[model samples]
Target chain A: MTDADLSRFSINQETVKQWSLPELVEGCGKAGVARVGLWRAPVQEYGVERAARLVREAGLTVTSLCRGGFLTASEPGARAAALDDNRAAIDEAAALATPTLVLVSGGLPAGDRDLRGARERVADALAELAPYARERGVRLAIEPLHPMFASDRCVVSTLGQALDLAERFPVEEVGVVVDTYHVWWDDTAAARIARAGAAGPGGGRIAAFQLADWVTPLPAGVLLGRGQLGDGSVDLRRFRELVDAAGYDGPVEVEIFNEGLWARDGAEVLAEVVERYAAHAL
Target chain B: MTDADLSRFSINQETVKQWSLPELVEGCGKAGVARVGLWRAPVQEYGVERAARLVREAGLTVTSLCRGGFLTASEPGARAAALDDNRAAIDEAAALATPTLVLVSGGLPAGDRDLRGARERVADALAELAPYARERGVRLAIEPLHPMFASDRCVVSTLGQALDLAERFPVEEVGVVVDTYHVWWDDTAAARIARAGAAGPGGGRIAAFQLADWVTPLPAGVLLGRGQLGDGSVDLRRFRELVDAAGYDGPVEVEIFNEGLWARDGAEVLAEVVERYAAHAL
Candidate 1:
């Protein structure tokens, strides 16, 4: 990639949920972006196989697939369905030639206050699916969501806890995502990131590194307020240095979920993301 | 204190911010709540000295003072003002016969992103105030707010961080507050609380224990969404047991900030709070 192209930068489509698959591929291609992050629903809507081919034809790489692991359902049928969906996700990741399949460990089961138990369910699901993912040459990347989402979105709330669950399997099969937004508040984050990426029995390793800022007065639901890089309190350059020090030289995906960004022109958002990634995270 | 009085129960004034000092003292005393938590703003408005006298005459114990320590202000003058305010808080707590003065470490100063630096400023302020609090027979208790408030309310966002800062001073001089609403999502919380209260150099000792439940769909600005005892996902009984196991047989203050409850009759809110605390926490 050219110095200005930032070959390591990947724009997560959710940053501009306004863009369609073909539109995203075209936009990234014209902007000289080498990579784009994909989400399951939209990729499946465009037909995973066709979508994969479209990006491939455009010479754009899929840095990582959006999600897979909401496997905390208590009902036997629901749990099986979650696993089946995860398996399909693995297949899609393989098709897209993306190495990492991000897992947002689902929230506690309905009416369930057992956060520990729900977290264990994530481990169980990972154990059952690791081999499948390993065989497909894909790694299941456990994304420890911010604690705000601990109750209703993801039970995994810390990098260390995510590492504990991811380390139950071979490092090549399972790993952790080090998103600056979710983890900047964690005091132990820098050290834990080092340990996770270190070579040892407990090495879960950094599977993906996404960038987003932490802003205040989070909107209702607190889901769509992820700040664009350099817009909030996160020290993006420091995090970049940490991941790089941990030996992760993969794509640094920009995966924001902000209402303001989504409302802007998709090309404008992509351009701004590119510029910010270069100025703040690269 | 009667056998079934749950004598350790204290209600933070903010739970019913509507109640005047006289109203709260009368209400809490009649409801068999032997102790009550007070905020500086309302106390000052009601005349701090007079408010203290009212609670004392009502035979109510002041468990802890609401807050002090917004030491993250960037301007040098503002920082001095925060320290001065904290010193005044210590005097107020002493006057009210409260042993603990909770400190909500302020968020980042405007246009500032140096979180580590801001956190260090809290440590510095505590060092400056701990001795003053000790002389007044009041312990400076650092309250670790939830990570969601890291940018706007408190830079100290984890129980461990508070303990680390508090442990720097004499155990009796400095301590940490174990507020369930703020720390419930921390995986290391139970262990940290134990460490804080344990008898050793690292033993920061629990200065206060407050309760609130974790609820979702946080309101706009996310300030007043604190759940009442049984209305949210927190297993209050479990936290009550954790603190008890840590040998903290002190006031278990019920603090919540829900708009729904705040809009209701103060008496009805206190009644439900008592009922919920008895059933869900005590």
Candidate 2:
């Protein structure tokens, strides 16, 4: 494959959530994928040092860490704990040599109606974590989830809102992650991607481009029904074209959260993901 | 009951979806609700003249028509047919004496990825029909649905987006319908309501205020499943206060679409609805 193809692909670990860290690395490497996005739980389970070694041994790049946010809750202690955990996550991402760490700003604090205040707290947490992330040469990528998740998942529910947060933080350390599954339905996506892309490298703009498809009859809890490439309604090629037009030439990471995909053999899923990505997203 | 109290409540026909039009009218009268919203199918089934006479006989007011939008489609012929039907719906709303005709901007055209264009088509249709509605003394109220319906239902999914459309037409002829179930989760709801309120009576803002509770574990094909007041997580009183703060003292129409509620006896549902409105909404 050409170097251009290598620069345009990455695999978010969620696409094969059932696999162990080493198995995921081996599978992705064999599939000709250059980069893998790691989720914190898996990294922690395998131990960060071992996970880092496995990734290195497999010659696979760690594109970005899956998460480091949920810094909002009624209890001050829980919020503080999230921040502490996020700091460790930043350290782990740095160790893995991942340049970006994604953050899904948590939902409304239980028993509270202060959405605006929760958003402020997210900004504050990002501000506090920015310096450490920058010192480690890692960038924070804020992901704006779909509005359906506004209540219990992420309060930052629009591309514009995520961009606002990115703009408020230090550009050297903070950026935005554009996931098609979440923001594809947004009317302002094209314009927002263009604006983010114009911000340039390390300028706190589009740090990662994650892919998944939109499907109907969202499952219970409304969080785990994400479709694999070509399995649902979203046109990933058009989305890729839009991001490319906006000057974002980053790796297109596949991040499905479907139970069916999760239950399959890791290698089989990885192979299908690579084939689907090339067919529907490239 | 005092005149002010009577004036503060409206019943959306869907609250008693299991009831026939005459039964709904009788129940509204028995409950002493001043106004009622009607769905097109019920109006068509009962015949417009009979429905109007029932409302007049019951001493109940027709607050707004339940719906008259879904103009977007794959074929031009289908769109034209929808527009023709909308015209007939406007005539029926006029015959029923409802002052406002609600619109649910339809979803993406089949095989079409242009959401922005679908939205523009909705605006264009509204513009085309505004004069007809104005002539019939029926104001058009664009109801912004929740984003979950962005794919198969309405494209106008936020108050801001609805207001943007409202701005495209003459304010006196077109306005926004603020449904709590749809817009309650929006982050900018308060600000949008404030903006709507600031645009005075003739400015076509806050033409209707709908109430319903949001419930989780939303059942599949969730076209129905609204929660009863105080039954879910939505803080109805807060929303009522917000709209009131925005200078909207209009009827708080209860528009529940729950299958569970629909199965109960019509009068029983109406009685519960009235109690919930008083205890939870006000």
The top-ranked prediction according to TM-score is 1
Model 1, docking class: medium
Candidate 1 error regions (>4 Å): A1-5, A200-204, B1-4, B200-204
- Candidate 2: docking tier: acceptable
Candidate 2, residue B174: Cα displacement in angstroms equals 1.9
For each of the candidates, give the backbone clash count.
Answer: 1, 0
Could you give candidate 2's per-residue lDDT for residues A1-282 as a string of tens digits?
222355668888888888877778777767778789999998998899989988998888889998899977758799889999999989999999999999999987666656778888999998899999999999999999987777678889888889898998766678888888898776678888888877765223888889998777777666887887886667788888877887776778889998989888988887787778877887
| Model 2: pairs clashing at backbone N, Cα or C within 3 Å | none
Segments of candidate 2 deviating more than 4 angstroms: A1-4, A200-203, A231-235, A263-268, B1-6, B231-235, B245-247
**Shift in Å, residue B263, candidate 2:** 3.9
Candidates' C-alpha lDDT: 0.88, 0.83
DockQ of 2: 0.45
Candidate 1's residue-wise lDDT over B174-271, tens digit each? 88999988988888999998888684432338988999999988887898889989877788889889888888888899999988888898888988
iRMS per model, in Å, is 1.0, 2.2
lDDT of 2 at A100: 94
DockQ top scorer = 1
